[model samples]
Target: MKRREIVEKKKAISEIIKAASAPEKDHLCLFSQFRHYQYKGHSFYLKSGRGDKLSSILKHHIQNILKINMEKVYGSEWPSEEKSKRKEMVSPEARYIFIYETANSDPNQMSESVGGRGSQTVCANDTETIVGFVHFRFTLEEEVPVLYVYELQLEPHVQGKGLGNFLMQLIELIACENRMSAVVLTVQKENLLAMNFYLSKLRYTISSISPSRVNQLTGPEKSYEILCKVFGVEAKAVLEVIFSIANSAY
Candidate 1:
């Protein structure tokens, strides 16, 4: 986005944040707070990096859940002697995390009954068992402020659920509310499953800075792709202009 448009959008989003009834809506789960966005019957809780306790849990998840996926993409030699490179990647000290929770619901009870949602019946301490997490931070890409997704890791048990898409929608909502022009992330070319999930399911496009786009000759050898979803009128217009210039140069 142009500088002027960015300023205006930030101002608008700031207004929305201020105008909202509360900072975040309460979820049925006991301990989550900050921001909540529900989609397709799933409740995703987002919170800024909290304490070292949360950080430890995040690292544990990355070690057990994300390491395999990373090895699949980056090559088999990626693991450390300890079997996890998470010491470097999953940094809850900086970015916020979007948490997918586990609610041990009893099938015996009707969801519609007075007992209500299973989440209400069970006291869920999110730190102990996190189904999945997405780490993201606000950043500038081509002069446009965006939410950059560092990682989106889910436990195998939670993999097939619609929670992934729901979490992304929640991220987009966050970017839209923060006055960001888009949501962006890096995906390894070798990780076809993730590439298809973002490109086909989420409708994100290969960004101009993606190794594939910036330098095609060397691009094919690069491991990752930068993908983005541009939003708002002004942001889209700016991207079109950037693409036109880039295409002409090529």
Candidate 2:
């Protein structure tokens, strides 16, 4: 198919969402080999999951990880930022790949129980040890289908390992498999480590839609920047190129 046609078809966000969420039997089957990863004497497994199916315990785990890692970055806005993060994490459209350490761990014990807002049936017996998680979703950006990574939080103990890079590679593969135009994510300017990781290590460009690129004056006022790694000509044109300047921010 022509690049224009692909971009035209993806204009319908519903279709992209449907295609991405349809693979229910084995969501990560296309990238099965990535499910297992080892680095720095640490072994871990990635489990595909949905936001709506997150157990109360898993929700707690995600919250704790985000706090420990992002509170300093968000500073005084941490409270409101955390609230937004919680809501986004439970959206039905959100998808996740949870990472768990696999040393002497029973496969059966790593089950996820379904729970969400107002879910009173909390599973106190849950004991899965999650070291990190990648939250993402299929969404429309500049009228093109793309995968937006909402969060990539890891425990302090696991920060220096190559796990972050490996997970991003898997995310890119998933984006390609789903015919996504690009892999997009936002990074706080204050978080220099994360900014360097995406911009320098991953080579993701500062998207044209990013606040910084949108307007040279007010752009610097924004706290974060949107970055993307585009896949095709259509994606590059719509997401990476700056055709005209307008009063907008992404």
Candidate 3:
């Protein structure tokens, strides 16, 4: 072929390659700025780093995003007995506990529900400033363990913005990537809004429902529903949505 024709053909191939790769390039650029971690109803960003550093940042964001008051949640004076009890529950590899205190409740009183031996009080972004928090517990039901969300809280200010859904989706993704069956959690029947959100909106199915177990929270045990969503169904849908959002951002 003539030299001029050869040059023209090469230029045409280069253009084709660029056109073929443009969409993927765009996708990467879109999601480049933010690192996302899904919780029940919120997508947490951790500025990307080593696992320990990312965990700390995630803990802080979770607490601040929910706007929880730590002092009020734990109370002015630390209950020594409760602290001692929690220390006992902490094992070598227990997941950390995150809390976003909405009401002024004693940490000692919360011990039964929130604190235990396997929990870590993760660092928050700041002191005396609160939004909400989530507590996580790790368990090995099978060969590959799963991280369970024991408690999730969001202050009044942060509620109603669909953060709960975002957090759940994030957690589901984490569970799926780890090859866990699903993220499991129990919610009180009395909390109708939460129940409705989980059942109706999130599409979580009730694996089991217990009627007010003896050591349950003060209210009429009502019913405690253990909800779960398999990785194939809900988790896949969530990842699609995240990609969609990232694409749309640009």
Candidate 4:
């Protein structure tokens, strides 16, 4: 082969290596940009995680957020006992909470009840405080990878600002990057606002519904719906755009 042709071939290989090794700029961009929407003087910022101090400020306000939804749906305070039991059930398979401390801890040293693969926590910045959080868990089902939105909550003061929709879009992007076939989540039927948010705006389809018969004997049986969305086509479309941009740069 001619020397010039050989040199050009080496350069093309180098470009491919550079693209594969370095993280995409879009990943960082998503984490940094917040689609701003305001209510009164308060502004909202949706992003993944936050500094330790900011997370601390939002911890106490979580209950206030939980209480608002609980009251509206059940006409009573969220039952601490029931919440504990539910946490205990899932603890065997995954840690219920995700934060710096939990993430930094050694998996072997942690209790069997805590920790799971691909679990992360994200915070929503509201003015000077962190007003909400979302917990994500990724798992493989029947050899196909899927991302699960285990939990999402916003402080009572920050609701109705369109932050939830923004966060959902971010989750979808992350799932696409990870090559997940679909995103799945379970929500209580009583939480009508959440039900509507997932179904109407996010385009999630209900896959199943299970009612708690055990709880029915004691009081009310809470029904839960499982929802999922396939992302194969969407992810391919996004990757095509990224590849086109990289090719243009070369």
Highest-TM-score candidate: 2
Show pairs that collide, candidate 4: none
Off by over 4 Å in 2: 1-13, 23-25, 105-127, 242-250
Model 3 stretches with alpha carbons more than 4 Å out: 1-125, 141-145, 209-222, 232-250
Q: Write the per-residue lDDT of candidate 1 for residues 1-250, one digit (tens) a residue.
A: 6999979876765554343212232222233223343444544444444223345665676566666556656665565523443543543332545454534233233122133222322224655655566766666676666777878887766677776786787778767766678888988776778888988788787787777777879986887888888986655644323552222111
Name the 10 consecutive residues with the lowest summed lDDT in model 4. 241-250
lDDT of 3 by residue, 90-183 (tens): 3332233232332323223222212332222222442333354444444433222345666667667557766677667655655554455456
lDDT by residue (tens digit), candidate 2, 1-250: 6998867665666676678866352356666577667775677777777888888989999889999999999899999999999999998888988887766333334444454321121123323668899999988888888999999999999888899999999999999888788999999888988988887788888898998788879998999989899999988988894554332232
Assess every candidate by TM-score.
0.66, 0.83, 0.44, 0.52
List residue ranges in candidate 1 displaced over 4 A.
Answer: 1-53, 80-93, 98-100, 106-125, 237-250
* Stretches > 4 Å off in candidate 4: 1-30, 35-41, 50-58, 71-77, 80-82, 85-128, 208-222, 233-250
Residues 67-181, candidate 4, lDDT per residue (tens digit)?
5545455544347634753343233222122112122122333322212332223322332354666656556533345666766767665678766776777777766665566
Clashes (candidate 2): 0
Clashing pairs in 2: none
Model 4 local distance difference test score:
0.49
